[model samples]
Target: MSNITWSFADRVVAITGSAIGMGEGAVETFAAAGASVYGLDVDAKRGRAVAERTGSTFVECDVTSSAAVLAAFEQIATRHQRLDVLINNAGGFWEQNTTESISEIEWDHVIDLNLKGVFLCARHAIPLLRQSSAGRIITISSLAGQTAIYQSSPAYAAAKAGVLSLTRVLASELGADGITSNAIAPSAVLTERIKVVRSAEERAATAASIPLGRYGGVDDLVTWMMFLASEEGGYMTGETIAVNGGRFMS
Candidate 1:
């Protein structure tokens, strides 16, 4: 990530799934850069703790629930009246199953969390984003969305692919409003969840396969996110930046 510094002073930034991993890193990074950050997540305890450490606001929210999403954005609107950046970072899948092996409930849950949540957040964030001179919508997607390089939850991959499509839709619809919508598709990011889900041997093997010869840290992805939210990134939209250490090239 280097020593690259971005000043988001006076900017109002909202990030979903801000309790842990990449989301939590973003909350701290943005807050440190002088932005007024709101960290939203379903885990109230960890969310609040992250907020306290970063000096940002914490809103308990489930991005999957329309009502909860509305309320969370409402709170942001009441406080800032506008938002400069919206980071759709809340998403995950529990079971790794084939398409046919996956149950309906599991499928729905993954889709809702990874895909629908982005839609809901962006849907409500558009108005507030319009108030900013250069509104930015940055979504976190997965390499699984781009390709089936390895075994993964079928629903997770599908949902992430949907996110990429939705990013373009938002960009197309909001271009006139000066809102730039983009997505970051990352792989081999060494988050806490990755540590739990993959055995050490699995992690090592994945790392070796990457051209960079290592797994990416949270900052690897978050740094690109910061760039997309920065003024310099305002000119670009509807594009997906692949940050996978050359693991999968398009």
Candidate 2:
């Protein structure tokens, strides 16, 4: 991602789950545009390496813990003294279980990571975000949040649904403060995780099922994310933009 100097020069961004996958894509995208990013993830070494490549700072954050989230944001604020954007991109599939058999422990774990994680980060980031001239919050969600469930557990779907709802509520609450909150709900994206987890035949089958006859790439969502984080996207708020390659039209 070659940078455009005019787009994101000197912007302050904090993104979670940035050690890999779509989160990594965002880190690179923002950095390419000249933003100084605070990349947060569980993998300290990999996160730092990625940040080094982009001239970003690395923060080890367990998004589910409020204390960790607070500390991480405080550290970012201390260094940059401002936060212009935040992407709550943590959370993913937990265990394979339906409502009938999903244990309470598993449910709580996923919810805390997915929904509570976003809440905690946003709850703490508000003050710093408000200090910026253009504050933006983009939460990474999924089609599961708006549609029926599938490969993911019920807890994942429910938590993402909560994120979608929270997007709307936060937009309403913070629009007056010059902050915008939005979500990206994606489907079958192509990543190392997906390639390693699914066999070729299974992956091909899923791709064929999509209307585009292919799985989504990280670049697909990165484009939309850039828009949401850009001045052009200033008018967009409380939007749950679906980037599923027409797999599920919403």
Candidate 3:
């Protein structure tokens, strides 16, 4: 993907939301890098297929459920005593509603998936991470969380913002154990879900708005993830990297 090369040999990596999009890409990337990879998702069929194609293990897990998350980690612990990296990559919102227009169910689903899921995974992953010399928690946040350039789901935005906060707290709490926690906030990555949500005209308009003059590819984000999970990224923690192609610069 990027010019930078990484070697994850002997590393044990676990990825959430591995059925599609960024999570799927992370599974493939890490596995190719020689890491023992495990892909977790609610979509058992697609998840199993991805694992088979990439030579990684697959675990059917609903991240929103504590019991499911615990069982998934238990399986990982049984297979590998420690975890090197945990990629929290499962989150999405179907509805783009205003604060008042959003329903309770919609809000809870978005918040639970985007925010609560991160918390649960981090909570469970900490023990395994502590067992590793260089443990990492790399979360996939969103540009919408930082700011709303367009109309978007209120719950999704709020939940993503919450992820940023949680990432920092995890970093602070786990830094003593030599574990680093960080996040990536990406914008306008043209995944299958994005393509379905935005029409051609809307996509073009978004591209024109970005200084980069195009939507981001999966590689762009995956490459950042690689860096965050590498030895070179060991010193950095409690920070969020914004990879939005100059769309929102702070």
Candidate 4:
């Protein structure tokens, strides 16, 4: 690890799905970096609590609803006037069934959350991000998007693939405007959610499979996010940084 530190002083960063999990981690990370952070999530109570704890602002917004997304961005714009970094991290994988076993509702829900949500947030964040000298759009994707994973649902894989494509397009289109777009695709991250779901043996097996002999953590992601949002990372765009402990190489 480099001894150098990255600063976000006076920067404004916006994150989606900020109530818990990785989103909450981002709030803490950015706030610690001296950035004014704003977190958006449908879980008002938890989101507000997280914001208060992390010294960030929280907005109640559902990524699936375009109206809610627009309204939230409008509020951010009103308060901050500019957004330096926008992280699209609001997504979930509920139904991990095979194609034949998955229902239409399940498919739609997964697609809406993982894929459409990225579009909704990006659509509203562009103008504000463009105003910043070092604008960044960093999205959360999955290893499943690049290749089929046994534990993931078809919808999740497809939606994440869509996110990568959208990221590339944003990078190409927004590069001229001094904006950079990128993504992070993590695998077997040992979040609290993962701890609850995976048995110790399963986790051990997973860890063994990875060359690093351990699962990734929120800090692993935080490192990449901070780097991409920093001045030193200005040259990187349309790239997906895999924080999977070398589990999958591309």
Candidate 1 local lDDT, 1-250, one digit each (tens): 2245989999999999999999999998999999999999999999999999989999999999999999999999999899999999999888889977999999999999999999999999999999999999999999999999556899999999999999999999999999999999998889888998899999989999999999998998889999999999999999999999999999
The best candidate by lDDT is 1
The true-versus-predicted C-alpha distance at residue 202 of model 4, in Å, is 1.6
In model 1, where do residues sit more than 4 Å from their true spots? none
Order of candidate numbers by lDDT, starting with the best: 1, 3, 4, 2
lDDT of each: 0.94, 0.89, 0.92, 0.91
Error of 4 at 186 (Å): 0.4
User: What residue runs in model 2 are displaced by over 4 Å at the alpha carbon?
Assistant: 2-6
- Candidate 3 residue lDDT tens string, 179-226: 999999998898888888799999999999999999988889999999
RMSD of each: 1.0, 1.4, 1.0, 1.7
- Residue-level lDDT tens digits of model 4 in 112-215: 99999999999999999988999999999999988888888999999999999999999999999889999999988887788988899999999999999999
**Residue-level lDDT for 97 in candidate 1:** 90
- TM-score versus the correct structure, for each prediction: 0.98, 0.96, 0.98, 0.97
